[model samples]
Target chain A: MLMEKSAVENGFIIDLSSIKNTSQLVFELSSIMEHPDVKGKNICLKLGSLDLKQSQLLSIKALIESMNAKIAFIDTKSEQTEASAVSLGIMIKEISSDLTADIAPSEEDFKDSEYKEEAVEERTENPVQDTNSQEIVEVHTEVHNNPIETTEGIEDIYDEVSAQELSEVIPSENYQPDGFGILAASEGLLPEETSKYILLDTGNVLPEGVEENSVNTESMQTLYINQTLRSGQTISYDGNVFIIGDAHPGSEIIAGGDITVWGILGGIAHAGCNGNITSKVRALKLNAIQLRIAGLYARRNDTLNVPYVQKTNEFTPEEALIEDGKIVIYKKLRRD
Target chain B: MTGRVIVITSGKGGVGKTTTSANIGTALAKSGYKVVLIDTDLGLRNLDLLLGLENRIVYTIVDVIEERCKLRQALVKDKKNPNLQLLAAAQTRDKTAVNAEQLKEICDTLKEENDFVLVDCPAGIEQGFQNAVAGASEAIVVTTPEMSAIRDADRIIGLLATKEEITSVKLLLNRVRPNLIKSNEMMSVDDVVGILEIPLVGIIPEDAGIITSTNKGEPIVNDENALAGKAYRNVAERILGEEVPFLDLDEPKGFMAKIKNAIAKLKVKV
Candidate 1:
């Protein structure tokens, strides 16, 4: 006889192969039931190998029940063994060659059992299955290999259905409204009262006739360089760039997003290289010979025409951004 | 005693690495310690000239490394201090003539006899720098207040930090203009030390005496009256595990000297 054991959540498996006699089967079953690991867990018996008489099947079921534990079995190909298992009140779990079958029990099998009557009632109460099942399928595929995830999906569906049925089963006349009026009053002030005033204050809310643009915006990643970018060094990134040290004259940095330098920046910096016109560059000391953002370029000789409050001859911290299709430099306001 | 081999390196040229090496070697020798100065600039040797021993060179470092002459025979004795010596680099040979392993071997043999071995490294972070720092246990990075020199000095400090043999690295801010620093135009010694994040070994002010001493084929440390001379002497003492306070660069001279000069002027007027 061939025997194999596998452990499942709150359950254990016993696969029997080519048992010769009733005595051998009894000894194996008793030894497994007495196992420390299998003592409290439900038993799943694979009966594909053992073709036994009706009396022998009843005896095994009775022996399992005597241990105060529930037992389920994968039905054998033989009609005699399958009928014997169903007649004896033993669960004949749907058999599949795939191991995932043990985790994902078929819905039909779940509805057939008298033990799952509550689950069937719950499913009948809830009509919104499309959205719920779609989410379940997503979660199931993400963790396809985890047996716990499969079991959790089944339990979630059952819980949702059961909860709906429980609400329906209660009489509506007996139900009392307890503080629900206050909760509804509080929720009513949420969207209409607060958001309406916020939109009014901004004065730039989109008109009702205008549909909001659904632009796909990717999250921008930032690359940080902790050391100075010396001459002959170049750093290129697909996202925002931040340099903690100086970018010397001969060095260059090209980024698809905005760039910020904590120290002196006297090099060539090209931001919004992927054609993002709104991208800007900021540095503690802006002495760059050339600055490029999107299609626009700004040279050091380009005088900043803005009305200045305090202008210094030395290279002070400033910000460069695209304005009217041209790059403009503005002195950074001290936050302190 | 097994002496320390300190490498003097500045990633940028004209930062006074040769001058600092020569002065520190002289100051250490003046303190009665036998010191050997090595000019590892290879093709651009200047340490011998700074030590005023260029004409007395019979063999160079390349000859010793190539096994053409004994290491002892290649050592040129200093005229000012008998305890100080110089191993000049070959003016014709490039840096490739001497490898890191050979330099380390030479430094190891020299350490057994000398109290200190100072190697004057060449500019740039190339083969020359690597060969100079190969056997050094300590490093002194000379940097001026200028952004370019300080940037290169920071890079050299980064490279030296990666070497396993370099146990310590210090900064020597050279050519600092006191008036510019007071006016907040030039970087102060504290600013240079803060950017470099290394211990300040010494700070040599922008002294014209340094140039005059080099012209006279003498290290400024030999001139007791020069501020730069006292700075070099203090650096040499600091290297020997002595704790000396940094000099005040704001004043033209020491407080006592300024008072004495003022009193002397008053006496002359009377």
Candidate 2:
């Protein structure tokens, strides 16, 4: 039941002397540490041959903390004397006892001979020493061959039981690849992929609803707009926009759902940008630059049409639809 | 017959909004039209004082809305003009005492009883201004020849264009001095209209009588003998669909004795 874990831990010896965009490089490195599979493993980033900026070092430390891993950066460019001074601290703590035992031999040999004699006498009287000696030999052989093999055997048992439990807990459609994440887009930017749904999905060629170039209002998602959008600003969402106030002209608004304006809407709005065909844009006042839905576009002010010299005052708030493969404007039926 | 309401406003303050409202109301009433002037300035109620009807205000617009009095009881009859009335704003309360819907309700009731309901709006484009424009079908932008006033007038016109579909929006240029315009020291009426890009309603020349009338709590329109007052009456007649000759601001004034004396008085006041 355990899937093949693609654990690829590669080391990079990045020459800081050759890299110019250090900040961008550090950001990419942080993304590497945040990779879903190897994120929890211990990572050692060895820094070399350069003076890293304060911001760059701080960001590296922050990335290490986020992954909950250990990092050891080897600075290889320091003076030899200074390098040896750091090594001196490591030698005193780790090598002092080993060096003394290797050098002071006769006194240590006399103590070791008595200890061996006591161990031999105890082994002769107790059968537990025989079993303990055999177990120690097996443990030493496993350590030399592959220490992680035992951990893998235990992991296989837990993986099968957990997979069975998880299958019952979650719906099949909710499952996605581990690396899947949400992409955030800014104003005027389009998403890489768009989704669309029909108003009436009959089993026939012709859609039950003949409405075209309109938002698929049955699946409208409401988006709350809290700011006064100025002229020349464009806002698009995969959901309807609820503007608290006016939307100025020279601005473009596109939504995959319905668009509502509590105040005036003097800007262009394209509902059902993903071709939902039933979404509608509503506002207190609608004097926009253009209107579009699905494959329909209301290109009224274009100069290609000769002598349709309509002033801005002549335009009124009217709904748009596609009729006979041509976009047209219609007067909204008055509620009164 | 419900009267069509119109609110006179400018985004910038002190560009003669109240003066235009008082004069236009007076001119409308002088032509035998039933005109009701509603001061929507709240605590800073100045229309009553300008119209010379402050002492006759027994109840304010707030008093009627609060059920302390009837709408009829709150209307202050103009002292000299029988056709003119004033709905004075409450001096004790701020603008929050009423909102756009409440003001709209009041104007709806008043429209049934009057020929024209002129709402004197506050200066800034805020709640007070919104209350003034509520239930109104038309707008009158008042501005001077100065750059700041013209800019604010453009912004107010832009806001009105966004809010509702208005049929007629005209600009009334006030406090214009013809001599300064002739000398090229001030913006001409055409200049103000060209920048704001709106239709010109009327042009009011600089007359010392306007200041004197404000000081005495009298509308300049009361003086039918005055030139600026006649200009206001012309604007009112135009509003009523009557074609009238515009004032010949470019024409040389006659060397008559009366104009000479008036010019001397204007200079002395200055």
Among these predicted structures, which one has the highest lDDT?
1
Candidate 1's C-alpha runs over 4 A off are A1-336, B253-270
The TM-scores that each candidate's chain B achieves against the reference are 0.93, 0.91
Error of 2 at A22 (Å): 96
How well does candidate 2 score on lDDT at residue B112? 95
The collision pairs in model 2 are A214-A277, A214-A278, A215-A277, A215-A278, A215-A279, A216-A278, A216-A279, A217-A278
The residue-level lDDT of candidate 1 at A214 comes to 20
> Per-residue lDDT for A229-266 in model 1, tens only?
87547789988899998887546788878889888776
Worst 10 residues of 1 chain B by lDDT: B261-270
lDDT of 2 by residue, B174-264 (tens): 8888889989999988888889988778888777667656755678787756678878988998899888877976653322222222110
Interface RMSD, Å, model 2: 41.7
**Can you give the DockQ of every candidate in the order shown?**
0.01, 0.00
Please, what are the lDDT tens digits per residue for candidate 2 over residues A190-253? 1111101111111111224544345346556677888777754768898777788777643567
